[model samples]
Target: MNRVVVLTDSRYLGQRMPGALIEALRARDMPAVSARADRLVAEVRAEEGTAPEPVWGMRRALPALRPGDLVVPRTRNAFALSLLAQAQLRGVRTVNRWEAVQAVRDKPYAVLLLARAGVPTPRTFLADRPGALAGLPGAVWPLLLKPPYGDNGHGIVRVDSPRELERLPWSEGMVLAQQYVDVAGVDVKLYGAGERVWAVRRPSPLLAPAEEWPEPVPLPVTRELRTLALACRDVFGLDLYGVDVLPSPDGPLVVDVNDFPNYTGIAEAPDVVADLVESRLTEVVHP
Candidate 1:
């Protein structure tokens, strides 16, 4: 039997996902274990201030791999994955290869990449400093101000004027200030691996009743989004990951790509953990 080791946070690894995946791997007579990547600095440095936790260890070392080694990430912290990538250079194979994850981890960076790749997305401005705002020729006013590493819209706000921009909370670091195209406040999440995919429409929690997204309502997916998602996944080098795309009058505008996005939400009515675990185990077996 081959061994699989998982690295991640103590909570999510032990109770949310990694534990169940380990069980599934074991039932197949494969050795699976969980380990945390809390000590990996190179990976965190890759994503700047972010860090990732591992959730698994797999069978054998991949190209340039060592005698007994494997890598798996349970979080979406890009900087942490950078550290893991460095370690792997010495002979370890990590899941979600760093390529794709790094591309989409930073919200602003994702916006620019998607645009350059010809994928439709909201206009974005990368503010290296307050002075950069004046040169934002393409950015519109009343823009959306987001912390470079923001998630869940926590530090997001509307900036309509230069004075407001001056009063912005971010004194250091960067931000993604992009045009705010307010539609019906609808959102979507797409999960994919190989040729299999699941697309679900989620009403923006900002407008949802009590923040409850509608049951994963299936929607019309375009080859563009799928192509873009696949490109992103390939960039992540992981076959499994979640993408969040927002809809504009023009069509779909990608908002983000979470490398280790949580499928835990599915736990509401279904065993999301088990489903994801099963899928991951299958990938390990076949890969």
Candidate 2:
């Protein structure tokens, strides 16, 4: 592939993409170009000396890609990953294939996949209706509530009991609630790239307006972390993601599986992401 076109949000078009990627492309003497959504779509001002693609919506970007080109989409939006699905339909190989990315975006669907794969995730229920909770087991006062669509722990809540459920109003889409477990302060996030797993330990970010976030436990490399990371990829079919497993008194509890986990702030830097991209590219070439 002579040209590698990376598609991502307007924010990290260049920041999160490893300088190493440019360096890696250069080492191979391949021409690589980086552009954000607006630039790629001719919406925003593209960097000087860059040619912008047609200003088409997310899905249109897929068919626009030619063979042997690389596309890295970081948006969790289904339409965003649909670009890859379009590419796949046209026989274009892309990183983190479309079907894989989409399957894990919905939390309940992801849990179902994990269950099918024999991976033990946190107890979960898919709330198909507002009153679906009436049929759910474990009618305890305190349980975890999650919206079908959530970010940064935004819609995740801990309800003390059925009393709290009464005050809440019903909405159109589905919602889910889970039995809350006693988790230690730590949340372990394992990042998988191809065959390697880079484990990072983050303290629980579950904070309220009046509370402060706690300190994180530094990551200690372990076989268990690697296994779980691989399991996440295999179960959800997502090639790139952040696997969140909370440690409980019982054992490790898999809490969240993010399609596009917060990359820039947490993953350390251009080095880590660059390494992952390069390895993926290498797999593409060698395979």
Candidate 3:
């Protein structure tokens, strides 16, 4: 029987969404299984007059998967992506294509594509070194500086002035600088699955108040926000993802895009994601 292979880390397997998704797929008789990406090994072979073959999960080998099997990428491991790339060549389908995951994994690359696609975003700049930041054109005060790649509010700094920018120990790496939008110390987290979206209001990492706001509060998904989120999906070819939007006077500005976000505040996300997976499976079976 064809199956749904959930590619994730062991840590996430015990988490809410990944754990729930496994059960949901199996409940639907989809023959779901979890493969901890970190524990899997892959072998790629190519020879004269033959297509490339990718064999995966040597450490804890997965059951042999056929072309019709579905791979749900729940982790961003590079090794996993390499394996997925080869698996795709062999006809395995991934929920969010590996290309989309790679694109959004690089913050600057994703932001550039979003802006070119005319998505509303904060003024942004990229630099190879901290010294170059002083010369960024159209830069505003209180810029949010971030490493080229990071997540969950890590490696982010608020530079309130030129002096502040110079005060920090300059690191040797690319940095993403953006116009920080202060929305009354709140951030709008837009989580999506297929065409559906849900919004939650959480404390802004860069502008949180002294008393932490209560756990992210669910918010109504507005028409404009919905359109914006979908546009991001289109830009990145993503089906399950998250968009971080800042409600500013200029309007909601997208600050970041995530691949298969935790769906932290969306209680219905697991079922919604399962529905999307089921639909994809249907397409594969019918086609």
lDDT per residue as tens, model 3, 181-208 = 7788788999999999999988886655
TM-score, cand. 3 vs. native: 0.90
For residues 111-160, could you state the per-residue lDDT of candidate 2 as single tens digits?
77887877766677777754557545554436778877665566677776
* Whole-model alpha-carbon lDDT for candidate 3: 0.81
lDDT computed for candidate 2: 0.61
Q: Lowest summed-lDDT stretch of 10 residues in model 1?
A: 42-51
Model 1 Cα lDDT, one tens digit per residue, 53-170:
3223243222222324455566555445655666455444555556666655667777766666666667777877554685555447767777777665556777776776666677
User: All candidates' TM-scores?
Assistant: 0.71, 0.77, 0.90
Candidate with the larger TM-score of 2 and 3: 3
- Give the number of the best model, judged by lDDT: 3
Q: What is the lDDT of residue 211 in candidate 3?
A: 37
Q: Candidate 1 vs candidate 2: which has greater TM-score?
A: 2
Task: Return whichever of 1 and 3 wins on TM-score.
Answer: 3
lDDT of each: 0.58, 0.61, 0.81
Model 3, residue 163: distance off in Å is: 2.1
